[model samples]
Target: MMLSPSDRIHAPVVLLVNPAAGRGRAGRVAQAASEALRAADLAVDVHETRERGDEARIAAEASATGARALAVVGGDGAISHAVRGLLDGEAGGGARVPMAIFAAGTGNDFAKSLVVPVHHVARMARHIAAGNTHVVDVGFVDDVPFVNAAGFGFDVEVLEHMRTPGVLRGTAAYVSTALGALFGYRGFRANMANDSAIMSRKLMTVFANGRCFGGAFRIAPDARLDDGALDCVTIRDISPWARVPLFARAMRGTHLTSPHVSFHRDHHFHLRFDTPPMFETDGELQQAATCDVSVSVRAGALTVIA
Candidate 1:
């Protein structure tokens, strides 16, 4: 990750606060997190983000320096941005930098996968100082990298519904949007092939780098962060009513047993859609340049504070 002009100050921790992320609570989380770090006698520099790409730009800047640890005070999108900044081109394949997280995003799925409790902001701060790093794999769709989960089909539609302003939070918000999207959303025709999977009409999915999405829905029960592969869980088209039970089972991670679901894991996957596909990576919506995508793994590319 690189630093911005605002991040020129020296501190043991370079804290990136995404003020606009996850409603309005990120500022509070940033304040509380800094207090915690200062309380531990560590010099903390809190850099509040002003725009969308600041996270990546500043993170890349910080990484270019010799900053000991970089912590993010936002949801997974902020993390995604910073990771992209850090790994942009040669930076990703070079010497790695450590990172910490203070979960303040709505989904916080990626943070949760690292077992970082949003409620324990101080502990997360302390972990930055402790600097015990754990290497974890990062999944990539072409050149763009994602920290948690990424995919298309129903998940993309669910994300579209999630974009609507609502009063709910966490899983409840996701559930409300998912239910609304389920009614009218239809799957796209697609073909996929990987070392562990080869299929067509594989219209839906929740390809995971971690265990879950939608706040705790276990998208992949057997996923391991350091496993050196991505877990691909594809869902065949089913009745909207049938989706209810399957989604319920997903909560407990038993949906894999369903006949409509197929599971595979590999270092790389190739996908082609009959039409262009819109997707999401770490809760951030995206679209592919063409009807094809190549998803690959950067085995243990990130060293996270856990």
Candidate 2:
């Protein structure tokens, strides 16, 4: 159903902008979105993150002050941070707050799922004011929360390569880096199990709360944000040459039909790796604290204005 613009929420919202996201695109979005929000007759408070991990602190402080909504002018990485603070803020008693995504970063996959208007800041502000809110699931790996998807193996390698993605941006950056990473990738060995099945030696394992990943790949075609279960897609180890075609098919989510891919829907999955490999939660890379990783979902845990 389409949200009617006549339905309005006049409550004040605090916008947290990540200046470094999308190579400075977030800063621009912050300026435009603030203007649009004020034009809608809504009070707006704006804050800019100066350094790493500032999103969590700023978001916590804002939510503690009883902000009606927290709008993030950045990508999934910043959203991931804001979510942690908004949920765990001591002053809020760990209560959830409604959030808005401005989609001003590379690989805005989470925002894509929300159907956020990325190219039009004015429309996005109006959408926020319309207050067509939806409650969605939030996934966690170990203790880290991710709103879109989290994974290891090949995708992690792509993230590592993304750190210095040269001149490309957005989906092009992801696709180009992944093509380069796929050739040398040796995959990994791990013991993965849930209530129904067990597996080992995989190319990549993704626990998806939303459908798309890496900006372009619909890695989990059947995923639903409000569903209680996470869609787990595990790609078995395949030759480097085989990965090329798999990558192509993943763009339209047609890769699921391939024999090497296995999909499972579950509330939780436990994995143990020979070595603690790097993993990513919402496009932000993290070194695994240990070889064991626990992925689970808290259904309907977040409220967002889509």
Candidate 3:
């Protein structure tokens, strides 16, 4: 279905590209997406991110300028940056615009969660031109917004290990780094509290708004984007040898049934680590300034063309 001619856009759709994403795949995706949008008779304004925080800045400017929509060509990290920008604008009373995501990152976890088409550029362009939109929830770690999962413990170590260059890329790189991390990475201790209960000695905990993490792990099998809540999954302290089977089961989302793991659903949570810790939100590393971090969900906070 398409929007009526009367509803057609008069403003340009801002195309924000992160050239470094997916080992430079985003540049090619941006080119094709731009061509497709132009062919569909939609005006496009292309911009490339050169530095660390460019995605959010460009997205904020686009929304503030009343752009028709913001089309992001990148992976989960880039999209998360854009989400933060959009939400920041919303909080400041700027125009709320729908986002079009072209997944060009290694994991592409957020795009997968939203069922966004990865290869069909022309179809996605048509969706954008038609103004097709869907509202979804957004998760916040302290003040930063994320469209996917916020991870702690083991996954943070996996990301740390990935800092060194290797022959592998994409999901292969993630898995290989994770396997390497398991050998030297011992679990961290934290206290997790929600509206219902408080638990301690957590090895890893995920505040999931999306179903998967690190490309392959179905960390939260039944999470829903618009559910107005989060799926909190935690792994308690276990021996490194014992974690091998747990890792295997997590790939299929069957680890939830394990005694060492626990799952709950809630709208808000407060997590306290033994010390300031490193964590990740939608594949972006974050350093907590203090030992305490708060997570909450904002229902229908984002509009996306899926």
Candidate 4:
């Protein structure tokens, strides 16, 4: 259902801005969003994040002050941090606060999954004014929460490559890294189990909470934000040369039909890598680990202004 503008009721909102994100343009974008929300007659408080995980701290403080809503201005990393803070605070007997996003960072993949407009601060602000809240599901991998997707193998390598100095930035960077990794990468062995089945794979695996990643890749086209299940995708071992054509098909979401690719839905799953394998949660690479990782959906766990 589409939300109407009349639904907004001037709730108090705190906007957390990551000044260092998007090549240091997030502060400007945050300012613009704040103005737009205020223009819509909503009370707005803006804060600049100090460092990594600062979004969480600032959001917790705002919720402590009785903020009714919290909006983050940055990429998936910032949003994920803020969501963790909000969720943790609520669990710790703090006030429940609704959240929103003003997409301003590179990729903005999570925001795209929400069907939110990019490069349009006013439209985002209007959504906040509408005040319609929808319950969204979040995915948990071990103790970490990722509102986007989590993956291992090739994707994790690409994420790691992107962190290197002089690596290109934005979606283009992801594309370049993916291409480089496809030819230079070797498959890793993993043991995976979901609610209905267990399997071993020697390639890449992705567990998606949202449909898109790497800007616009519909890696999990059938994924639903409110659905109680996670969309799981696994690409079996294939020659490096074959990966090029498969990747091309993935762009159109037709790769699922390929014999080497497998897709399914599960409410919960556990994964174990044969050796310490690089893993990524919400596009951020985590330390190499030989640990057990589990993913489960917290159904309707988050209230978001949509």
Candidate 5:
């Protein structure tokens, strides 16, 4: 039920702004989004962050104040930071507030997967005003939350390099880094498994809670956000010559049928690598010296405005 203004203790909605997100466009976008929310007749609170971990602090405070919802104004990185804050803040058992993505980031990959009108804060504000809500799954990779997709291998390395400071943003970064990694990097061997079977010599493995990631790569084409199941895709070690066409096909989601590809759905995964594996989630690279990775899904953990 919708609570009246007097019945609500906090502002009806809160916007957590990461100014550095999207390579510095977040500040402007957050301002526009806040204005739009006000125009919607919604009591909106705008909080700007100058450093990392601010989104969570803002969100935790908003939740403590009983805000009706939070609109995260940035890319998946901002959203992920908020997730950490929300989950940690409510560790004592407070109800987690609903969240919406404003999609004002470089890739905005997670927002893209949700078809949330990339980089359009005003329209998203309207959609939230209209009360469109969908609860979607969130993935926990080695205890860190990933709302969109997580992966290891070629893609993760590219993400690591693309995300380096001083590089370009959006798909340009992804494409350039991917080409660089593809031509010079040697594939690695790893082991993967679910409940049924174990596979090794993995070239690339993706555990998806949403369809596309990496600015536009449809790695897990059949994945669904709210399905409560993790979509798994694995590409066994293939020759460097074959990797190019495969990535091209992935853009159109036509790579799933290739003989080198394996697609399935599962609830959990156990991954092991000889050395610390390069890993990425929601397009942010994690410098985790992780030899073993555990991933599982929290169904309907995220309530999003479509």
Candidate 6:
């Protein structure tokens, strides 16, 4: 849905910028976005996040002060943090504030999920001004909100590797880490239960909320923003040699029909792994979990201006 400039809403908006995102360029991006928003005649309060999680803190505080919207200029991680904060506030009985994004991160998976053009800050500003807000669903992993996908096995291992020094960031970084994992990583065993069946897999599993991750890779092509359900993808055991082509096919989302690939749709599920596996939400690795991981969707939980 393309929004006209005249349709833009000039609601009270607070812009939270993460200076450290995208290799310390988020501040500049935020400044540019702020200038564009101001030029559009929108009232904008631009604030720089001093540290990690500050984006969410700032956003929550601004909403408490009667701000109706919170605009974020950063990468997926920053956006995730901000959303978590906003949802936290809502859980604590605060008003639900709408969100807008000015993509500044390396992959901007959430923006891609919304079909928001990454290179069009001016058009994004126009959309913001137009106030075209749509209610979207959010996924929860163990009751915490995640706006993107969650992964276990090889993907989680790759994210772990990317956090080390001398490791690059973005799609290339993920590819490198994925390659390393494919060559040397061993798969884990997990028992998963959905609405229809309970199954066990000895490979990789992904719960997708958004289609694209690690840049252009379409891990879940059929994912819908407001579908009120999550897509669960599990890849059964495959030899290392077979993984090469599988990885290639995943880039184009053509691996869905592979013999090892199994896809399911459900609103909720529980996953139990034989050994604790690393968990990631919106591409950020969380602490290893030994207990059953619960996943669900909050339908129409967030309002986003794309």
State each model's CA lDDT, in order.
0.79, 0.83, 0.85, 0.78, 0.78, 0.78
Could you estimate the TM-score for every candidate? 0.90, 0.91, 0.93, 0.91, 0.90, 0.91
- Residue-level lDDT tens digits of model 1 in 1-306: 445434533446778999987788898989899999888667877788899868987787667764667888988889999888767623654335678888878878887678655558878777776667798999998777998999888877877766677645566778877877776776767778652234444447767998988785888988988999989998777877887788888888999989888888888888887767788898778988888888989998888887
Candidates 1 and 2 compared by TM-score, better number = 2
Q: Give candidate 6's whole-model lDDT.
A: 0.78
lDDT per residue for candidate 6 within 175-257, as digits (tens), equals: 87788788787777767765222444345788888888777678888999899998888777688999989888989999889
Stretches of candidate 6 above 4 Å error?
1-11, 195-201, 288-290
For lDDT, the strongest prediction is 3
The per-prediction tally of clashing pairs is: 10, 0, 0, 0, 0, 8
Report the C-alpha displacement of residue 131, candidate 3, in angstroms.
1.0
Instruction: Tell me which of candidates 3 and 5 scores higher on lDDT.
Output: 3
Writing each residue's lDDT as its tens digit, candidate 2 over 141-224 gives: 999999999998999988777777364657787898889888998888878865222555688999999999998899998899
Question: What tens-digit string does per-residue lDDT give for candidate 4 at 123-187?
Answer: 87888777677888998777678888888788878887888998877887788779888998878
Model 4: pairs clashing at backbone N, Cα or C within 3 Å: none
**Candidate 5 residue pairs in backbone clash:** none
Q: Candidate 3 vs candidate 4: which has greater lDDT?
A: 3
Candidate 4's displacement at residue 225, Å, is 0.5
192-305 in candidate 5: lDDT tens per residue? Answer: 765222544556788988788777688887888888989988877777888888888988889989987888798787877787776877766776557887889989887777
Whole-model lDDT, model 5: 0.78
